[model samples]
Target: MRIILALLSGTLFGAGLVISGMADPGRVRAFLDLFGRWDPTLAFVMGGAIVPMAIAWTVQRRLESPLGDKAFSLPETRGIDTRLAVGAILFGIGWGLGGLCPGPAIASLSLSPVAVAPFVLAMFAGMGLHRLFTR
Candidate 1:
C-alpha cells in the first residue's frame, strides 16, 4: 500500500512538472536568468507549492501518524550547518547550469530521454559520490 501510494504521488508530481512547463530546460533557464529576460513562472510554481506544504505541516502537528504509515520519517536535525549550506550551494549551481533540478530532470526523461539521460545519470552519480564521501 505504501509503495503504491508513493508511486502514485511521484506520478502526480511528474505530471505537474510537465504540465507546468517545469520539465523544459529552456523555461527553467529563463526563470533563473535574472538581469536578462527573466521569467517568473518558476517562482509562481514554487509559491503555489508553499500553500499546500504549509497546510500539510500544520496538519502534521495534529496527526498521530501519517496516512499509510506507522510513523513520520522526518528529518531529525533542523539546523543550518556547513554541510547544509554547501549542499544548497552545490544544488543551486547544478540547477543553474543544467536548468533542471532533480524533480524536473526526472520528469523530462519521458519527454526527451536522450537529452535528459546525462543529467539524470550525473545526478545519480553525484548522489552516490555524496554518500560515499559522507559515509
Candidate 2:
C-alpha cells in the first residue's frame, strides 16, 4: 500500500515536471540565465507549486500522521552551517552548469538519455560522496 502510494506520488510529480516544461534543460537554463535570456516561466511554475505546498504544510500541522506513514518524518534541521552553505553552493553550480535539478533531471531521463545521463550520474556521485563524508 505504501509502495503504491509512493509510486503514484512520484508519477504525479514527474508528470507535473513535464507539463510545466521543467523537464526541458533549455527552459531551466533560461530561467537561471539572469543577465541573459531570462525566462520567467519557471518562476510561475515555482509559484504554482508553492500554493499546494503551503496548503500541505497547513494540513500537516493538523494531522498526527500522514495517510501512508505511521508518523511524519520531517526535517529537524534549523540552522545555517558550513555543510549547508557548501551544499547549496554546489547544488547551484550544478544546476547552473547542467540546467537540471534532481526532479527535472530524473523526469527528463526517459526523454533525453544522451543529455540527461551525465547529469544524473554526477548527481548520484555527489550524493554518494556527501553520504560517505558526512557519515
Each candidate's lDDT (Cα)? 0.95, 0.92
lDDT of 2 by residue, 21-126 (tens): 9999899899988999999999999899898999999999999899998999988978999978988998899888888899999999988989899999989998
Q: Please state the error at residue 67 of candidate 1 in Å.
A: 1.7
Q: Write the per-residue lDDT of candidate 1 for residues 1-94, one digit (tens) a residue.
A: 9999999999999999999999999999999889899999999999999999999999999999988799999988788999999999999999
**What pairs collide in candidate 1?**
none
lDDT of 1 at 20: 96
Off by over 4 Å in 1: none
- Candidate 2 root-mean-square deviation in Å: 1.1
15 Cα displacement, candidate 2 (Å): 0.6
Clashes of each: 0, 0
Q: How far does residue 78 in candidate 2 sit from its true spot (Å)?
A: 1.3
lDDT of model 2, residue 18: 93
